[model samples]
Target: MSPSLLAALLYAALTLLLLMTIAALRATLVITRQRTADAFTPAGDDVSPFSGRLCRAHANCCENLPVFGVLVVTAALSGHADITDPTALWVVAARVGQTVTHLGSGRRRAIRLRFLFMLVQIALLTTWAARLLWGAMQ
Candidate 1:
């Protein structure tokens, strides 16, 4: 498989890991009788600060996955995976960095760092898409 495809799969795995974390945290709360299962909100603030961050992180992944996936898959389908391969793994690394920074702290510096990581992913993906488009036009 191409590195671009592998990167996309890694991104999916990371997203799933975040989801499982939310589930485990909620389950622990319910089991301890600290809260009811139905009491959890989509915003996750009803639970804890970390839960809220977790929700946001998971949502971020969900939002960006398709954007990255479409580009990677399209490149592969059109035999342009080479265009995306160089920086594809870097995008995934940046994504993980963003999520870790998000979950690590709510401080200003952490937020800034998280935003930087997000920008890296966007820049890489945007460049990849442009290259793919240019290649297809040839």
Candidate 2:
């Protein structure tokens, strides 16, 4: 696989890891009788605050992952991996930053940082898309 493809897989794996973490957290809570497990919805009165953070973080990743995956996969498939590879690395960095920031705090500064990270990802993906489209137009 090309670097872009590898990065895309790593991105998906990391997102999967985030989701599985929430599942494990819920499972542990249910096992300990800390909370009862529920399907589909993330927020619940029975869940702990720490678990709530995990849930929300997982939800955030879930919302963002599809677009990122699509763009990266398109780049790899369309033979524009060379242009996308660096962008993918930067996006991965920003995505991790966003997740970590979200986990740490929801304060003004943290929210700003999270937004910045998200913007970085959006810009990187947009760049990748533009480059791919531009190349295809040739």
For this target, which candidate reaches the highest TM-score against the unseen true structure?
Answer: 1
lDDT of each: 0.93, 0.77
What TM value does model 2 have? 0.86
Q: Give TM per candidate.
A: 0.96, 0.86
Give residue 128's lDDT in candidate 1 (0 to 100): 86
- In the predicted model 1, the residue pairs found to clash are none
lDDT of 1: 0.93
Candidate 2 positional error at 37, Å:
2.6
Clashes of each: 0, 0
lDDT of 1 by residue, 58-103 (tens): 9999999999999998988887887889899999999999999999
Mark the regions of model 2 whose C-alpha exceeds 4 Å error after superposition: 39-41, 44-46
